[model samples]
Target: MEVEDQIRRIMEGEGLEFTELDVHPDQAKPATLRKTVSYIVCAVILNDQEEVLMVQEAKQECFGQWYLPAGRMEEGEAIEAAMQREVKEEAGFDCQPITLLLIQEQGPQWIRFIFLAKVTGGSLKIPGEGDQESLQATWWDRVSPLQLRGRDILDLIDSGLKYHQETWHPRTLPVAIPCSHVVQRLVLIFSNAEEELWVLLVKAPRLHLPTAGAVKTHTLMWASSLVVQDALGSLYYDQEVTALGVLGLQHHYHPTPGRLQSRCSDGVCFNMLAQLVPDPVQRDRDGEKLEVVPPSQPPPPENPRYTWKRIQSQATAEELFPTVAPTSHQDGQRADIGAATVAPQLPPRPRRLRELGSPEAGPGAPAAGHTDPTAGSSVALRPRTRP
Candidate 1:
């Protein structure tokens, strides 16, 4: 399959990926429900009147207070499915996720998926209809005189309104590939000075992109560099790994309800773009020869279990690699801002995905509306302000 097309499919919930934690399984703490990790899904739904969809707390600690519809994800439940279930159970309305608006995390162990959703059908659950899930559901104007479960959701509501006003990133939803643990599905790439693109793939089980498990000691994004550091050995520090942005996510509830979920994994797989970036500081430090110096490529890994496959399709290459075009100055001189000295392709073009900067997003999280970077596993998630 074409490389870019495969990614598109994954984003649309039509594709699947195999976990590669076996490559260095010891490096991660795989998801095992209440054991290694726990996932929380929160929904932020807004109505035409600019009011927010909210439910009164049913839990004794905060009874009759207002909050967004959210709940603990079941051991064997899809992320979106869990969100929908919570919305219905709490709000008494059917809803669908528009996109994953934010990711908040206390590391991957305690993560929350926040989404901007739309009410599809159903009436609000009135007072008597309240059950253990909620006392009642209602749409509240931010200015209304309502007591809240917590003030924290104020930021979340604002975040939702901001996204409703302007969409800062692509429409991202969960990919439905079954996984037994939490992993980062890497579109890990290395490029030559000529912009010949290649992706890293795990050779075992099947020839697929590498999926690194999350190590609780560090944030999930660290998984990419960890694998690189392990596989590349001495070459690890010569180049930097740039987390471009999250392309999509994969999650599904695959275990039987009421069954102990400890045996199976209910973690998410973040499909992301991470590139091995070579440092340019020493590009001319080696010598003062006036001759134009060509850049060096990261050497192939000595590990036989890993392989780099070149991208032969030009269209696929462009989707993965950012591009720069010449723009004319007021003086009529055209200059290319990208570092590449050549006509096209290579690293450090302008980025469209902003860093979410969530600790869950880990390292180079984009500030745009996104997760897989942190709204994010960092999704710590002081509600993210839209850039």
Candidate 2:
């Protein structure tokens, strides 16, 4: 009796629910149940011939592909009307549909409507004089698998031809299209104090595209940093010694030098003149004269410091030996003497963190005439002192 009672209760619940069910779709399914409308794309082919009109594809989404004239259907446009308009715009010729070639359904979001079209009239031409259309339309023959630009085109064509004799349904899914961007780097250098900056533009030739021009393949940050190192090593004594911060920049598509600009860390731009002197004992005995002095031979222990007082020695000598020397000389002789004048002595200014212009010689501090305090500085002979 208990088992029978349980069965009775289940049946009563089922009966009540079934009695309340509505069979009409208006009550059973809401209007919102509609699936997303799939788009219809068309492929129009001219009659059996060696030439089939085609156009080049653009944009990172579908780059370098040749596909049939196709697009999404506009509001109120019949599916056939959309196909006709697409063919006219893409192929520039009137096309009459003969048969539906194939259908490609992709996911719940995409549908492709393809057809066999016959060329009737109006010469096939590219749309918008080949500028606004983004492609040049032309006739082609012997469509090879290798010649097709994208897998979509190849798949559509093969499916159409293969299924021409029978009806078939295809199960497909959406695929992600990948894209990339190019990066550019710039190095700005001020070679003079007049604020005249020279930009060094270096790029790998392979990174450029025939159409796009100087496409950057890396991030601007990485490019700029690498270029900074390269510029310092190739142009200066040390990267740490001379470097500036980046300046304003705009996107550049042209292939030119100095696309990027920057300012030196220091406001001034200057040149560095360095000399290395060897120990007196290790001075080169057999080699040609060199700017660098070896370590084995140290410079003299004491020498007059380089200063205006030392530089004025010649003027003083001329004054003291007035009776032995002529005050006036030929212009050519003076010019020759001037050319051989001693290098201007400079003082040490703390090395600026930037290079913006030719540096002025620093003032020399008082010291042994022939000895520079800095370990790497040069030593020059000073006037001899009478004992």
TM-score of each: 0.70, 0.31
Off by over 4 Å in 2: 1-35, 58-60, 126-128, 143-149, 159-387
The residue-by-residue lDDT of candidate 1 on 137-214, one tens digit each, is: 888988879998766566567767866886655567776556667787777777777778888776766677777787
Q: Which stretches of candidate 1 lie over 4 Å from their true place?
A: 1-8, 11-13, 27-30, 58-66, 125-132, 143-159, 162-171, 191-196, 203-206, 255-265, 279-296, 302-304, 322-351, 359-387
Tens-digit per-residue lDDT, 1-387, candidate 2: 222221222212211011111111121211010132334556647445534566655434545556667776554444456677777776677877654443333211333455666677776665455533325566666354424453344433443443333323121111111101111212222222221222232222211101110111211122233433333443222221112211111111122354322210101001111111122232245854545422232122121210011112332222111011112221111111111222123222211111111111111111212211111111011111111
TM-score of candidate 1 against the unseen true structure = 0.70
RMSD of each: 9.0, 36.0
Task: Return the lDDT, model 2, position 288.
Answer: 46
* lDDT by candidate, in order shown: 0.65, 0.30
